[model samples]
Target chain A: MPQTHDDVAETTPARADVVEMVGLHGFVQLAAFARLATDAEHAPDLRAQVTISRMAAGELAALDQLETVARRVGADLYEAMASYSTVLADFDRRTPPGDWWERVVRTYVAYGVLADLQRVLSRAVAPDGRPMLDDVIADSGYEDFVVAMLGPVVAADQQLSARLALWGRRVVGEALGIAQRLLAEHPLLWSFADRQDGARSEGDDAAWLRKQLSGGHARRMGRLGLTA
Target chain B: MPQTHDDVAETTPARADVVEMVGLHGFVQLAAFARLATDAEHAPDLRAQVTISRMAAGELAALDQLETVARRVGADLYEAMASYSTVLADFDRRTPPGDWWERVVRTYVAYGVLADLQRVLSRAVAPDGRPMLDDVIADSGYEDFVVAMLGPVVAADQQLSARLALWGRRVVGEALGIAQRLLAEHPLLWSFADRQDGARSEGDDAAWLRKQLSGGHARRMGRLGLTA
Candidate 1:
């Protein structure tokens, strides 16, 4: 984390850019919670329903902490959050899940890639930004839960796994598209990635800085007996 | 709350029925959260959006506590909760909201009436039951939020108030029907209400043990500049 405005200004993201990154992180969390909460509602198995609902609650708590950080840094949470609502909404409309299994794979795959993206942005942000990201990006935490719940089913049914492998590919493609658009719109946050990683990758590639970001989702999908 | 099985058996609801009541309560909390979380999603005003999302989170927390009580009493939470899912789902299907204001009023009116019904059932159940009910029934707490948020808007627009007034009545009407059906189905739990309140009007009217139950909503509606 950068210590001073001048130092951060010279290398990492500036204060305003940090605030914007925090807000964008909040939007990601709010969007995930809203979508998973719906999945939880339609989940017929009470165990799955309750577990997903609890996961959704965890996402909201992460958003609340980020909002607190945003306010502390003189950012209007709503203003910061609403700034990128359409970016996520467009992704949602384009990748609407066709069935319960699709919904499960969608949440499982999309959350992984987005959380990983949030983590990378955290590395590039100012001091306060890291904690906000830290709360959301517990590496492989959500992945473990979704896999344990869905992997057994996917393993038992060859047909379901084959169908979901395709769905998983589609979800990641759109997720990456939104990830690129967000980084493109906020290039200052992109600079933080370059400064932190010491990579000379183009701004568009800022979102994919470490192959490790996409690796987590692909590995989780593989665990589920589906292609990434 | 009743301490011993025999003591609870003598006058209050049996352990099984008490467990059923707890599960039914869980369904109520879960359904409210599911509905309001969607309301939070559609709420365009960010302040209202976050506040409703927070309120939705509170409903889930209340559900979690009841689930704890249910499990402590050896109730399979899923079985207990699923028993009443259709009852609430049917209520939801019948009274779909027309717009955002209707959505807000629907939550406000429906939650008030149902929580009051849960409170009355608590009075008659075994000893451990009251606390579960108490957590969900904080006495017009949610109403305060709705009134403050919508009261002025209703006061300013005669057409919106009239429209919402109709919507509010419909929501309460359906809410009361489901509340009545639940009491009718679990007549043993209804007996707990009579025993605790010392009122012998009728088992069918068990849900209406006290006028104060419905009064909360009617009064809150008046405060919101709508006819209850």
Candidate 2:
């Protein structure tokens, strides 16, 4: 469960949990992308793809901070993270990429959605934790790489564009579903959702997050020459 | 075909080809190890393991040099590399590691052999190309990480040590077999062996390389509490 509070002292440990969960998830996602970037068949530019992955590894610096925070608060980082594997793994399982184009779209779309959510959620974290979160999500490093690699292929094949656009929507759908499940299962997240500055309801947060996710996804699709 | 020469000017392009072949092979080996490092099941420490993989990625810096060299000479880097793929892929196919310990041992042993051979062969390259080749092989970053990870595990289980030692030998066998195939198929390499300074024969270089490979493997086994 991940929750954030304005009164930082009282909810310090939970905030740390929130950060660890986000940071660990980011690392896991980036690591998977790093592996996929090595797929010579599907990757647009192996060098640029690898570059994006190394940049993704840059997020590990923030992961270090979150892990430290988790330790200081006596949180069992692994135990706290155990619940996430199911949802995250489910997202991967449901939307397995069949080839290189699918890989590019899935990576670009899913990571974009997660990055967007992390950006919105970072505001709820305590001040110390927020900056690092911001840094992790700040640079969408692979966006141009995806466009450059996949754009031409999509332009050449109408069938691929349609398939990829559908793939992009599926990723957004799956990611949002996981986020919803995450919010529901974790009390910390529920509190974070419920206890934000004003009386914004969970539905409102979900809607806002969804808007951001779709906006990002649409822009990414546009970049890759796939219609939203 | 990639060949080296004492006469620097005429053979400059061939020297570059030779460097690209070796550099690209090293990059491919490192890239494969990078993927294996992400396997949490066998890796002793995920963070340290990933660090080693990233260090492996650092080998790509030499890859950039090789690409430059290949382009300057109008050599198709991939085309020149096509012949060696069989041997390289065969090595991987035959010596797949089943667990984390095996992964560490295989990666360390196989990479050590390649790095050692690269070190020996780098001497034949023109002066300008030698430094980058040397830099790529110099650190052996993952060796320390493997010893730190596997030493205690093997100490706890004698049977594991025995298994790893056997595994180490198999990796060496497969690697040497690949090298033989690579030398036989590539004229540049045959020339490299045949046309080196008149005093030495191909048998001498091969024997010297074998000694270095075996000695390094034996020492690594001892470090890991395994009998050579």
Candidate 3:
């Protein structure tokens, strides 16, 4: 969903802001990874916990590289990050994990949705930022971690599966709510929505984003034995 | 603080447990890094925040390597992790960061002391785990980040400096308290203290640990422009 507007190359300042937003998302990934790494009760299996933590740590390293990309393009990393912190923090507050299983599901679903957005943003942004964004997107190695942990849990516990299915939906709801809030507040981000839809209105952009995010969320939930 | 006891080579199971402890500490590092990476308000300065987070992330990578070493020595990573979780969590809870500055100081000081302990433990454990421990200890790169952030803050603000100096002392106090408790609860951890002190009493081991940790803490504090 990339726009090949030649002027896109000239928009480094704005694109840098977008790169910082990606970095901010990197922090979110780091936070989720940290939660998984330290959730002792839910993650009783040390091997699994370590495995997940390493994956999360790998994401942070990728974010570190992305920050470097932002700096090279003259992005005000702190200012860009500050603008979106409240929306993300609120989203996290509304979607606190209930248990170990819920934590894994949340990590899986949230990253999946964010990766979809990143995939679009990586393409819509300036080319310099594109490669870094691509690397950051490719760092979505949590799929194996999620399947290994949740596949068996869902198979064994039908009641737990039902609960998690509902939980997964709530996560999607909260995430979309946050995504909508982000788009509404940061009209700049709407550029991604617009470029993807070829000069669409904000309303259409929101609808498109919802469809895009929800479709990905449904596929991810199905994989995890949860109803979207 | 290493002893040259030849018997140190024969304790593979015990050594394996120690390696797992290293992995658990890696999670502690991961958790702390995640908190800093996500602490939007306190970490207002993006450069310092990202710098410290990168350091913490690096520690997790080192721990991943250490886990491989543990496996090589037949250590049960999860069991070892479970046993030490309480001690590390208690240390973290009691020394909770009051603000962003406290967060940085806490990470710097705890890791410094742990590196020292790991230096001793790495040698005391089997040779298989020694090289990994050496790498883990060598990964203590927060020194520059701490100096860069705290040095200026302390140089500019005397009141803040005094507050953080005292805070640094409290972090050390809480950390040593946890170390002593671990030594008491897990008699095996006492082996490190014992190897250093030639069968000294618990009181003496505690004193030695205090001395060791305090000396390193003072050096770190001085470097950061905080009072020892």
User: Evaluated with DockQ, which candidate comes out highest?
Assistant: 1
Off by over 4 Å in 3: A1-42, A68-72, A125-133, A190-199, B1-42, B125-133, B189-203
Tens-digit lDDT track of model 2 for B72-175: 45565555554454455567678878887787787777777666555545543455543323354446467787788778988889888788889888888887
Tens-place lDDT digits, model 3, residues A111-192: 7877677665554445554433445555546776677778888989999999999888888788778767766766665544
The candidate maximizing TM-score is 1
* RMSD after CA superposition, every candidate: 4.5, 5.7, 5.2
* Candidate 2 residue lDDT tens string, A63-153: 4444554554556444455455556557777988898778667777777776655655554446455422335444645677667767898
Using all chains and alpha carbons, the TM-scores for the candidates as numbered come to: 0.87, 0.78, 0.80
User: Candidate 2, chain A: TM-score?
Assistant: 0.74
Instruction: Report the first chain's TM-score for all candidates.
Output: 0.82, 0.74, 0.80
lDDT of each residue in B71-177, candidate 1, tens digit only: 55666767887777788778878988888888888888888877777766665344555333454544425678888878989989999999998898888878877
Candidate 3 lDDT (Cα, whole model)? 0.62
Q: What is the lDDT of residue B122 in candidate 1?
A: 67
In Å, residue A14's CA in model 2 sits off its true spot by 7.8
Alpha-carbon runs more than 4 Å astray in model 2: A1-83, A124-134, A138-140, A187-199, B1-33, B37-49, B68-83, B124-134, B187-205
Ranking by DockQ: 1, 3, 2
Candidate 1: tens digits of C-alpha lDDT, residues A153-208:
98899999899999988988888777777877777666445233455558436445
Better of 2 and 3 by DockQ: 3
Q: Flag the better candidate by lDDT, 2 or 3.
A: 3
